[model samples]
Target chain A: AQSVAQPEDQVNVAEGNPLTVKCTYSVSGNPYLFWYVQYPNRGLQFLLKYITGDNLVKGSYGFEAEFNKSQTSFHLKKPSALVSDSALYFCAVSVREGGGNKLTFGTGTQLKVEL
Target chain B: DAGVTQSPTHLIKTRGQQVTLRCSPKSGHDTVSWYQQALGQGPQFIFQYYEEEERQRGNFPDRFSGHQFPNYSSELNVNALLLGDSALYLCASSLAGVVLGEQYFGPGTRLTVT
Candidate 1:
């Protein structure tokens, strides 16, 4: 079984400030991690993914996530936040054991980037 | 290229009724996966279709079924709908054989079981 945990229900940060949305996971084998963003009443948009590469994976919209194997964590970070960055963020994990690639996502963290 | 697309953006159905939602995978993609996302919750995997066969499934019941066509489009059918069945059904598409490929999701079909 695989699972993801998003510790905070909501994260508040001011515009132009750095922001971090925490995520952790548990899986039997090597973990393939990913980040996604969702606007109100919209579907999820892929942000970034950490398959097997540099611990620091850069992605769309100036967003990046660090895969920490020891800690079993992948935290999404951005240097400066904008009001438009406020949205629901989800962290997911997947492994190749099953024939299908199904992602297990976290409960989700609501990001509020205010000016 | 167009991304994954789903049909019947919003629907209202009575309990005990059956509903079928449709999806057209992103161009050049060969696999489709279905998920159920309840309000205030993350999406839950329902099943995955590849080569017109169910490759794998999650913890969902048999009431949740699906089919994949030759062109890679798919349909999700749910029977005996319950209040809990009311949720946003999401369809995602990705190329087959790509290890841990990032799936592109559709806007999702919002189903309300009255």
Candidate 2:
């Protein structure tokens, strides 16, 4: 079974400061990881994904994630946070092969960027 | 591209009633998946439909069923609704066989059971 874990229930960061939302996963095979953000009353927006390439994957809205296979982690990062960036973050994992497009998602982490 | 769209932004139903949610896949997409998200929790997969057939299903009971039209639009029907069925139902669409393609989500239909 593929599973994702987001250890933090919420992350607080000041605007213009760097922000990091932690995520880890457990899968029997290679992992396909993704990060999505959802604002209140809106649908989830895709941030980025890590299939197999550079460890650091850049995504929409100036966000990026590092895929650390050894640590079984794919933590989302932003060089500078913005108050508008505050939203609920979700980490999802799927098997690299034969998983049939099904994704196992984390419980989600609320990120609050303050001015 | 019009993105994914769902109908009935909000709904209220009583126990033992039935409800149906609708979704239209994004333009140029052929696959649609349904998910149920409880308040403060991650979305749980209900099923996926492609080419007017159910390709895969989650651990949901028989009460949950779906249908896909030739145009790639879809509908999710829940029978004998329970109070636990109250949640935001999400619909996502993606290009089939894209290999882990990113799914575009709709705003979701908020269903409240009374």
Candidate 3:
């Protein structure tokens, strides 16, 4: 079964500092990875995705993720974090072969960027 | 264009009661997917619909049913709801037959069962 793991339950960072949220996956075939952010009482917002090319993928709100095939990791990063960037982050993975389109997600990581 | 939209932003029901949540996919999107998001957890896939037919389904029971209209709108119906069913129900839409395309999500419906 394809699954994702977010090691941290919460990450605290001072505003204007760089931030990283770790994610790893286990899948049988090539993995399609995604990052999503959710605010309180709001639905998830797509942050970024890694499909075929480019190990480093950029996304909305100045977010980027590096896909490491050997380590099975796709960790989200930002150059400078803002207070508004604090939210619940989810890491998801899908198998590329089956065409099932089912996404297995991690529990989530709560990011708190304090000003 | 307007993004995906879900109706009845909030609902309250008692145990064993039924509930129906509606969703309208974003413009140009033909596939709709439903998810259940419990507090502090990631969203769980309930099912997916394309061309008004159920193309994929997760491990949900038969009590959780759905319908997709010709216009690409969808409805999720849950019968014999339990307290555990109280959570945020999210609806996402993507392009039809696209395997790895991004799915646009709507503001979810908050269902609370007492």
| Top candidate by TM-score | 1
In candidate 3, how many Å is residue A115 off?
1.8
lDDT of each: 0.96, 0.92, 0.93
Candidate RMSDs in Å, in order, are: 0.6, 1.1, 1.2
Summarize candidate 2's per-residue lDDT along B33-93 as a digit string, tens digits. 8999999999888988888988878889999999999999999999999999999999999
Each candidate: fraction of true contacts kept?
Answer: 0.90, 0.57, 0.65
Candidate 2 Cα outliers beyond 4 Å, as residue runs: A96-99
Which residue pairs show collisions in model 3?
Answer: none
Q: What is the lDDT of residue B59 in candidate 2?
A: 89
Candidate 1 residue-wise lDDT at B66? 96
TM-score for all models, in order of appearance: 0.99, 0.97, 0.97
Chain A TM-score per candidate? 0.98, 0.96, 0.97
Q: Tens digits of per-residue lDDT for model 1 on A1-115?
A: 9999999999999999999999999999999999999999999999999999799999999999999999999999999999999999999999886578899999999999998
Q: What tens digits encode model 3's per-residue C-alpha lDDT throughout A1-115? A: 8889999999999999999999999998889999999998899899999998999999999999999999999999999999999999999997644344767889999999998
- Which residue segments of model 3 deviate by more than 4 Å? A96-99
> DockQ, per-model, please?
0.90, 0.65, 0.69
